[model samples]
Target: MKLNISDRKKKVINRMYKITLVIIGMVIVLFNDTFGRLEGFVEFLALYFILILITVAYWIFKQIKSIIQLKNEKEKTELLHLKSQVNPHFFFNTLNNLYGLMEKDSKAREMVLKLSDMMRYSIYEGDKEWVTIKEEVDYLKNYIELQDLRYHKKSDIQFSVQVVNFEVKVMPLLFIILVENAFKHGLENLEKNAYIHMNLSESNNTVNFEIENNFEIRHNSDHQGIGLKNLKRRLALVYPKKHTLTIDEANNKYKVALTIKIK
Candidate 1:
């Protein structure tokens, strides 16, 4: 469940206020002169039990609220670190592509413009909690075009995106990590018949993205690279139970499918 930090804090404060009222009621019962007699003492005993129950319940609630807030903070911190990691890794790859374009004396001007668009999007839109589906798709297109410039005729790649609702929002750059992984692990080293197929479709306020790529497996390479691991962490932090991620590997093909329920 996505929780608002302010709303959670307000609940904690309200519970604490209820606890204070319970304490005040207990003090009033102990000090009132009308409660000195036996009947009054009996009333005090019953009231004490009720007050104790309220206090215990409030205390438990406060503790649970504190724990949840702490967990959210930790997740946000980890996600921020992961976001920082993405920029450098992305720039590193793109810069290498730019260098290759320069070396080949290819369309450096067009590639630079595409790179600039990606950089502007990452700097401006990527930092936000959510971005429109159209913006993200444009960014992905730029990234793919840049990748295409870097490796021409060496790999077969198909990308298709269909959006039923253009206003749909999602966490920015979440799917790019998967695309980067496909290129890094699958397309870079394959000598022939390398293929990457990606399809994205959105319906009923849910987005589904799937990527499949064929690659030569390396025994020494880690399957869960930093980008994939960070992507999983970000998904857990942002979507919680509202997302599904699946990975399958067989016949030298790696397939990943992610479904996200969006607001």
Candidate 2:
């Protein structure tokens, strides 16, 4: 489902070539024939039928191929935009954390290396579409670990991860946004209980994701911020109507559940 730019271009070119071939062959059969016409209208009708069939076949193929290309281009464009937004937000958040750490702790320097690795994946790696679920899960774990370190004192954050299939691929940063959202409003103002629970399961060519966290009613003013709003956009663009997304906010608990079909 994730085709690179070059691959998409190649597919378009190949389809064009096939259309060209069909057209040339049709032209040859229609005009460059050796048969002399001493026949009735039925014979002419038969010839036209064959010609129309060939052209119609090619035309249908052309249309289908064009639709696929257009869809891919649209998806690619949207994903790149998501990556742009996500990379900056991620950098800003991480740098803010790092800045706070640098002000009082010397070990912040060591954590910078890990941050660099994360940045490498976000900024330089192949993030145009789906990445191996394993890679994304690992990235999520690293983020949670870093957040734990940042909130070492007076932070009661509980995080969990479950990866059922390493081979399955998912849209990049699909699950992490929920984690970030949970931390932003969940951990930032921890008065009673601050906890984040995440679970991922893959079966029947589907990915099940759930993230639940305690929500402080006070900080939930900006409920539809850039992150969650953009996340919904990304989900619509990537999964269309194939995936199911649910948000449950009740009893001071915020929960997000989405199931994506990988197949």
Candidate 3:
């Protein structure tokens, strides 16, 4: 019966039952003189007992339904976690085979390894609330190296890091969007003398990242992209008042700076 009834239908039926019982009780109480006083009292007691039984039954049903729902959710979560594990293993195996086929000293082989490392980090560490700064820096370097391989033009790109403690942990993938945007909106549109400069530094529990790139003025647009919007939202959620993000665009150049205070 429970399986056949929808939640909405069950709720409606429950409400109707309550209303009917209430109306019946009111009618019985109002017509007490028509029946003997003792008989009226007996009827009232029976009705009250029935109402108590119904209430207890409903409470028991709700507890059982809650337990079943929780069990189903747990099973679904476990299945998804297993699938996630399988996918990364499959991906890495394929990459390994491809890597073996390439020449030892080939740029393609190097790119494949870098790509594999990036994929591994993204799959395993990207979702983590915090990761060592060193790991994030390595991921960024691999990403930059891959980008460098794809471009035919020799755009000047530089990344510098100054950190007192490499093991200091911060939110993962915090700076990749800015770096990606630098290439997407800045370096890609420029024809000559294109440059991207990035710097990351940490001091007094504060982490700062800055990136600047030159772009063609004709290719500039006034609208903010979704990536930046999402990044801003994430910053507001994760750091609240402890983070600052600033963007400056002028003279055919785009610059972004992000500062985060972490424990």
The lDDT per prediction is 0.81, 0.75, 0.78
Error of 1 at 80 (Å): 4.9
lDDT of 1 by residue, 2-57 (tens): 76999999989999999999997786677666766656767877998999999999
* Ranking of models by TM-score: 1, 2, 3
My TM-score estimates for the predictions, one after another, are: 0.71, 0.64, 0.61
- Candidate 1: stretches off by over 4 Å: 1-81, 84-90, 96-106
- Model 3 C-alpha lDDT versus the unseen true structure: 0.78
User: How would you encode candidate 2's per-residue C-alpha lDDT over 1-263 as one tens digit per residue?
Assistant: 99999999999999999999998677556654545533444476689899999999999999999999989868765654554334365567777888888878886886787677677667654455678888777777777777777666455555555556787877777776678888878876776567888887777788888988887888887654766766777777778887988999988899999898876
Candidates 1 and 2 compared: the better one by lDDT is: 1
What tens digits encode model 3's per-residue C-alpha lDDT throughout 61-179? Answer: 99999999979766654433333222244345546555655764367777788887988887788767689989989988987877776566878999999998888898777787788
Instruction: Give the root-mean-square deviation of each candidate in angstroms.
Output: 11.3, 12.8, 12.5
What's the best-to-worst order under lDDT?
A: 1, 3, 2
Clashes of each: 0, 0, 0
The per-residue C-alpha lDDT of model 2 at residue 36 equals 50
